[model samples]
Target chain A: MLLDLLNKLVSARYPLRPPGAVKEDAFLQKCIRCRRCEEACPYDSIKMAHGDWGLKMGTPFIYPTAVPCYLCSDWPCINACPTGALEAVGEKENVKMGEAAIDETTCFAYNGIICRACYERCPIYTVAITLKEELYPVVHKEHCVGCGICEQVCPTDPKSIVVFSAHR
Target chain B: MTRFELHFYKHLNRYRRLIQILSVLFIFIVPLLNKAGMHAIIGTFYSVSIGQLDIVDPALVLQNLLLTKEIHFPLLLAGIIPLVITLFFGKVFCSWICPFNLLAEFADKLRKKIRPKTIRAKNQNAKPQYYWLVFGSIISVAAVSGIPVITLTSMPGLISGQVADLIFYGAVGMELSIVLLILLLEVFFWPRFWCKYACPVGAVLALLRGKNTLAIQYDAHICANNCPVNLKKVSLCNAACPLQLNPRQKGIYPYCYNCGACIEACFNKGGKSIWFTFHPQETKTNKSGS
Candidate 1:
């Protein structure tokens, strides 16, 4: 009786499961621990970290708190994903939460070549880009807000930087 | 006691499998729609014994969706229905429902085409070393990564995705080539070998199979003596289980999923009332007759 009452109360309080909020532990348990998703992430924000949940080792993660989600129009991660672990499509609002990354070696600004086009063209340039006095501009990852503007503007043969979103 | 109650029970008995199948269809089919708009309707959390948790807890497939969020009633049921079926029968889901199982079977044909003639490794005593290797390193890695890396990088998934991508991109000319490669790899070698050895999902399921509330039972007279796994006479029950578990085992583990593959197998063998019990030890029935 008590359990029943408690169940009822819990349901009333937290009725909504915020679609796609299902725990993926069971599926993660089935995962073979490959790095395909990591390579597929346009943001390059995915990393393999096995901690706390010893059972969920070598899985993909995007620490959005460390970075920010930059919505990629064409998600390579979805295209590249093989297992159902990563759904081909997902929520747009949630997808916007994935973080982005930049490789300084490929950034035109790193070569003492002034390429602030990414910063100027970025939708969130103010939050996603920062100017460094060293050579051209140094991107502060903390404040850089991985929007992929740098990646898109990057004149390198093939864009050498990317970002990622938390694929929860 | 009442006629209405008896009638209801009869109907229930007949439609029970139908209900289960419908539930599974509802589960997988609905979530598929979530992909169309990338607007999921389902939430992540579900109520478990240990309070509330993510519906796709473990995030293997949902994480792959990569949409903002999704509503997937079909997916939830599709996933949970297998467990439900196991609780009542014996890993029937593996034989009938699993898309992966179907894929593996499809690949089996292709694998056979190019499969190298092999020296059947003497069927030796299997060891627990593979289990340790599985849980110790691979599982730990998945836990840390918050995703199942095992199947993602799998050659099969990669190959399939490549073929699908080629088709999706309208590279019509490339489709035949990719299909041929996939078919050759899948049919020529071994049928469902990936599930037996490579599939962690299979591993998890095998562990849970014996615990099934419903499962297969042994009949001594069928083979006139030898066990089903003796792999000689063809029997439906033995052939049904995706794991290829011997239906004639003593006191099967309690984790078995009640897929009725064995029952169907027995039916083909001219067995009777094979599916007599809904749960373990509920009824003592000799379907093959005295």
Candidate 2:
């Protein structure tokens, strides 16, 4: 119980950048902390990254739970960035901030309780998340853009299904 | 209007306060104003833009330069603009526009009212940490992965961005809790703790202004001649200083933001001895008396 609590507390749940974030090193160098990306995000998903991340402080990021990106068709964040820190990647599928992975031990469907929360809410639907026996969810790494809708919609407390930030 | 009727410093103080309030308002409105069709005004304290023009924080830019080992153009411009402003203005940003100072002023007022008279006396033990923080950040950034860690302690930039975040994005982070904790500290323990001593940004502004001549000038001859008895008493200018600085002292230039409160106090006390000027004055007078 204590370990579970600690895991929830200290988990590496770093916020994912908007649709068109460059690699971490380039992003840090390129971003002027203009906050244009945050402002352009229609869903209010983007927020300025504060001190906790050290040097990336005042840069833009999106916490999925607070407000997940609605994945607008035009991608306003990329367009708003004047510094090219966030490039205009062509498609929603092309912009991979991170990938959603399931912890089967805590997932209700895996525990025979029958839940398809992640599979139902995933942006890519059948491709990103698919149902096993038409019930338990299985995440396909290639199809998942890590928009974080699945994690946001996850019914399980401590989120059985969570999106881990993409390793640049 | 006649020179006597004009109330020069009073109007200046009012203007400074107006700018400070406007800056705070600008941060609050940034997200609202920045939209798809109306991409007119955007950014927070770290950076800001009006149309195509942009202003970036020099300290953050310098940190990025140290870390990345490559010079970026826009960020360099952002960093240089503030440094240039600090060059002519001499830490006027702290007095006229820092959003954190507005919050601190309110907190300081509450502190003054709530705390007893005995404890309200400015503690003499408080040492200025701005220099150490500035240098320490540089050393640490070089040693620890080249990323500037100074922003972690930068109250103005951090809080302004966070408050904007909380209002526009409906998001709050650990920094809010940290700010609240500091606010609590400001109210009870030490007044003007962060601004007077700790802020790295303020340290950078002070260093940039290094003996640059623009400062609160103390006319000792005038004070010595008129109201010499009042000069022996606790100075109104010293009491008016939010940073607990003696405006009459020559050494106060480096730390004096030219906030004009001291001048206001002097005016209130029926003396116009203290005033802002760009002329270099004698440093010897600072050692003479309180």
Candidate 3:
């Protein structure tokens, strides 16, 4: 439909939404773009989408490489959302911002560099990421909340481990 | 002007400027307070919370209702406060509280200063219906596309949001450029263009005015009988209006935000022809030429 095409055209990038964000379509519909979530984040992890984001301008997103969500236990961002674009989940661990994937070709650990940066930095270490044969770090996608702490801490120059947006 | 009237009218604009400046400062102060571990008051103009009370933009709430196809009671409740204010006060938010309006006023002054010979064009003042048309188009586009498009264009929301962003993140986003671009156009080309003809936020607020709402009332008899100024030329009230509206006419009420600039101008010009009154019936003047 024409509406779908317009939505697609305006949504320039599927940037990682903040914790407790609803589905992208619903989020767009409900979000009034108040920037309350941005103000609530203690780590300043939430950022307002700017002009480059097309119609998504004023909506909140997180560029985890620069400042990853610390994933506060209280979910202040969700509490700050007045429009219900961000709903309160039962547990912080249940937050599914996106899923993380590691590129074997660029990964230092895969290239025998023995990097444990991502595994060590993972908030849900044992569940989200595991040691493969006691050397490689393997991501369990279902368990990974995609907070992007691993991407922030990745030793690789281009970030071997990246969190892809849940919607994408 | 009498000594007492002079004293009073001089302070009217001074009070307005104080409120305008305070609102601008409020945006930055809230973020700084939030950073200092305070959570009592928060958010930008799009929506804000002062303790347990959530005050949201009525236009955004309307957009949300259209796009989501549901009634959100909390947001609806939050939106009512502004609607009630606009219902009684007649878009005072634009003149007294909107930071963008303060910036636009400065831009209008600068435009006059840079080009002193600039003449007021007849077409400069857009018809009120055009503002409604723009508002309707925005709402329709938002409903169809399932996007809150007004949030992208709302100037007050953008200004407050960017201010918070600057305070928290230590840098403003590219969205500030949109404001800058509008201001550039305001300075160089059209004066009071966005608020008069384009802003959906103002359009919605202005439409909420009732017959009893605070509005600028003009006494034609005072101007026709008592005024020494030439009626053929631009009167002081018309000259004082930032939106270039003829305050003497009732038709211009929709475009008027009860800024009282013209009222102050009339007082300064030694004529109490124009003033704000909630009860328009008591101050009803003769149906003469505007």
Candidate 4:
């Protein structure tokens, strides 16, 4: 059946999230199944899969060969995910691949101490985290990898720098 | 002339319930809740080249956004009410209003057919680890685009008769196994889990939901003696939230969508303290849950 071919094509390229992740099947069912993921994909790899198998419901999948995973921060695709189907998670790289949170209180903005520890230390070297005229450190989530590095280096006790992981 | 009714206002819960009722109306009462307000505009502009419709979504808006330079007025309102509701009510919409939410719960109905006993929600606040792949990819793309591209990917199209379209056009001899699998997952795993965590709109709303908006209130005295944390997290209502809100929080958790199922569930438990605030007289004394 064509469904068989479709499944094989997808499986060969990308693997599904590990088992035990049907966080909300009911929620996924109602999704209108638009291809928002395609637009958000920095790599232009995501495609609206053939609905023949009905596997391509509301969630969008990546077809690596066409584009491959271009790991942009914030994963606008995750942010665009209307259902939990495209769940969010923080990577270990501590490289922010998404928006970073700034605790205004402890943020260097209020810390009275000048430091762009995150901006300077970022591994991607794009200055994803920026200092707002010596104000609080604003995170360009697009560059953040959810690696908790900013959070780790935050001098504030409350930890002004933090990433909202699994937030996509 | 009349004195302000603010004195009598439960303040928070009033707007909370109003948000809930409004979301319900948006979802259920609307002609096509999923595709409401999307067709006429996007149809003329996008003209999806699908079946007979020949509608192309991106083309319609992209052309408009680029050429006309005038904002597609409707696009401004796209997911506005729902998004605003999430900011105010902590995603109560997921539980009460969204038809998909209702269907998600109904899918669980299949569960009842299988087992008379209900499987309770446990560990409601477990940090989602799987999101790494999901959020990771999305963030990667956003970084490159410098725009919220997910807007185009997620958030189902709200075209009219979309359900029928899925049946006739979408379901045409499609894999029954995938459909059944999604159904099985909905019935067994987190019922409305997708709406709870993965919804990009919901996430955006939550980011801005830290305020005095209307939200579920778990009064310490009442919740300690009568909270429903047993079913899941800190409270019964919290556990039921498709968005996984912490009912015990003093103010809105930003993710709360104001869905009233939690209110209904709490009412079922015979808790009088749980009140839906809507100014004054409108406060419905729960005949039954929280």
Candidate 5:
């Protein structure tokens, strides 16, 4: 019965939940659908998913293009959660919401252009992203928290550096 | 037989509307405070915790119970405040506090005044929507597996929170549409449809009220004979009720929000027939003394 619900939730195009969201299955069960996280989000990064489907209703999620998590030091979204759907992580680097991957086809830095926008805007610049000697941007997946700031600041029309949600 | 105290009824009526307006105003103010970095002073639609004390919606508590399959003691205790209040007072939240009800009431009046010909849906024998409780719990179990379902339909929280987000951020996301649709539908289809038949929160509150201990008691003698002038005129108490419930009927006690509107109407019309009181025995003596 539970697996049936899980399959239904995953079948849809799932957006990334907040930074400290628990594993998807646990998050589904624990979230009371109170939407306090949406209220607490400072940047208005969190928006409740709206669909008529009974399974996807009133859940908090984020679309990077609209607003990306600012990664506040206090982590208000997690603190505001009454249920432990979102848990506090020991370090911001450990708050693994997703992974950022660079699309070589669209990346200006990769196309021999002098663009280091992603690296420059990276919240965890030195650790998660770095610039090579030729000024090419490289994303270190291991250290990336995937807060999506780099994606938001990407100069490409559609971001060359996109954060793939770890949730799915 | 009893006489309604006009002054006391007037005072209660004034405060009831005052509380309702304040609660609705605070709905907008809370999100702004949240934006200003005040973490301690926020409560969601499901639960409201101020400082240390918490008061949760009992319907949501039931959902948690279905999902977790065990009692979360802190949440249970948090829910007790509203439950205990409901047990004693009977559905006061619907009339005097819930922001959605206040808006719906205003919408109802506007519809009546602006488009008097609009045919409002009427369910004369409306019963508490128990199916919502069953469906809500089933959704909670599914949510436990994957999917947060109830927040989509929790009108009070969704509307107020979305309104707050709109004011603070100047962004109206798709979530606001559901609430807007309900309000728009209300202008034509049903006046107070959600609260009257479908609100799970109202259903839970009605269930929590074990007996009609604190409710409006009708004095038939006074209503029929004490004030001939009131009887000659149209029934103000009946017309004043936003829910369109008859306060003069003992059967309607469970649905009465103790909003004091009927009491005010009765007092104003020199009827003094319908009065809200706790002890039936005490009100008789108290009314005679007054």
Candidate 6:
């Protein structure tokens, strides 16, 4: 449908939305681009999409490499939303921002370089990321909330582990 | 009596300027307060929360309702304050509170300074309908696209949003350029053409007016007999209007934001020809009855 195409065009970047963000199409419809969530963020994780985002401009997104969501006990961003664009998730662990993926070819651990940075920095720790034979860190995708702490703390240049937006 | 009227009229613009400055400052202050660990007040012009009271732009609310095809009580509740304000005040937000209007006023001043003798072509007759057309098209585009496309063109929202971005992120976004481009156009080519013809926010607010809405009322008897500017090519009030509207005309209501600029101009010229009336039509009826 025309609506579907327009939605896809606007949200083409599929930027990592804040925690408890509804589906992309619904979020675009509901979000008035107020930036309350961006200001409400204690960790400065939420950022408004700029003009480069076209129609998605002013909508909240997170560039985890610069400042990853700290995954606060209470989602203040969701609470601050005037519209329900960012919905409330009952439990913090239940928050699904996106899913984290590790590129094995470029990973330091895969290249025989000792790196446990992502595992140590993961908010969920052993649940989201675990060491394989006490050497390689393997991401447990289901447990990963995609807070991007691993992507932020990753030692690799291109980010050995990255969180792909779940909405995409 | 004349001196008192002049003093009172002069203060309207002064008060309007003060409010405009404060609204601009409020945009920055809210973010600073939030950064300083006070969440009591937050947000931009698109939506703002002062303590427990939330005020969302009614245009945004309408667009959201259309796009999502859902009834959201909280969102509707947030939009009521602005809706009610527009109903009574008749687009006063466009003149008084909108930071873009304040900026456009400066642009108008600069345009006059740069080209002092240039006579602006008046197209007042065609503007209100054009503005409504623009508003209608934007709403239709929003409904079809299933996106709140109006937000991109909402000047006050963009200005306040960019200001918040600057304070929070220590840098402004590319949206600031859109505002600058419009301002550039205002300075070089058209003066306040955006607000007069294309601002969907102001258009929606202007459309909310009824007979009882606060509006400019012209007293023809005062103007015809006593006004100093009557002999001049253009009356003081008509010349003073930023939107180039003839204040003496009967149908300037929809385009006029009740800014009192024309009223102030009339008072400055020692004429009591124009003033604001809460119930314009009713006041006329009462005068005839008496």
Clashes of each: 127, 1, 0, 74, 1, 0
lDDT by residue (A1-168, candidate 1, tens digit) is 332243244332211111121234333433334434443444445544332223333355554333323546565444333334445445333323323455677777775676776566555555555566634544445553344445555567655455443222
lDDT tens digits by residue: candidate 5, B172-201: 657767776777788777776677656667
**Candidate achieving higher DockQ, 1 or 2:** 2
lDDT of 1: 0.41
Please state the i-RMS of candidate 6: 1.3
CAPRI docking class of candidate 3: medium
Over B147-210, each residue of candidate 4 has an lDDT whose tens digit, in order, gives: 3333333333332223323422353223233334555676776555555555543454444444
- Give the least accurate 10-residue stretch of model 3 chain B, judged by summed lDDT: B281-290
Compare the candidates by TM-score and give the number of the best one.
6
RMSD of each: 13.7, 6.0, 3.0, 22.7, 5.2, 3.5
- Error (Å) of candidate 2 at residue A2 is 26
Listed in order, each prediction's TM-score against the native is 0.45, 0.75, 0.90, 0.40, 0.80, 0.92
Two-way TM-score contest, 2 vs 6, winner = 6
Which order, best to worst by DockQ? 6, 3, 5, 2, 1, 4
**B115: Cα error in model 1, Å:** 12
Residues A1-168, candidate 5: write the lDDT tens digits: 564455465555556889888776666666766767887777889887654434555678887877888888988788777766788886788888888899999999888788977788778868899887848888898899888888888889888989888876
lDDT per residue, candidate 3, A1-168, as tens digits?
454566578764688999999988788779989988888788888888877677777889999899998899988888888888998886768999999999999999899898899999899968899999989999999899989999999978899999998987
Best by lDDT: 3
Q: Which segments of model 2 are wrong by more than 4 Å?
A: A1-11, A22-34, A47-59, A63-96, A99-164, B1-6, B34-37, B116-148, B169-171, B210-213, B286-288
Candidate 6 C-alpha lDDT tens digits along A53-88: 877888899999999999888788887888899888
Clashing pairs in 2: B56-B78
Residue B38's lDDT within candidate 6 is 83
Better of 1 and 2 by lDDT: 2
User: Which regions of candidate 1 are displaced past 4 Å?
Assistant: A1-116, A126-142, A154-168, B1-36, B41-54, B57-93, B106-193, B209-212, B218-246, B249-259, B268-270, B282-290
Q: If you superpose only chain B onto the true chain B, what TM-score does each candidate give?
A: 0.48, 0.86, 0.92, 0.52, 0.82, 0.91
Model 6 lDDT per residue over B1-290, tens place: 46665686767898899999999999989999888888888899998988778888888888888888888888899989998988888899999999999999888988889988654534233545666777788889878867677788899999998888788778998889999999999888877789888887887787788878888877666677786754345567767788877766555756778889978877777788687777675223112210
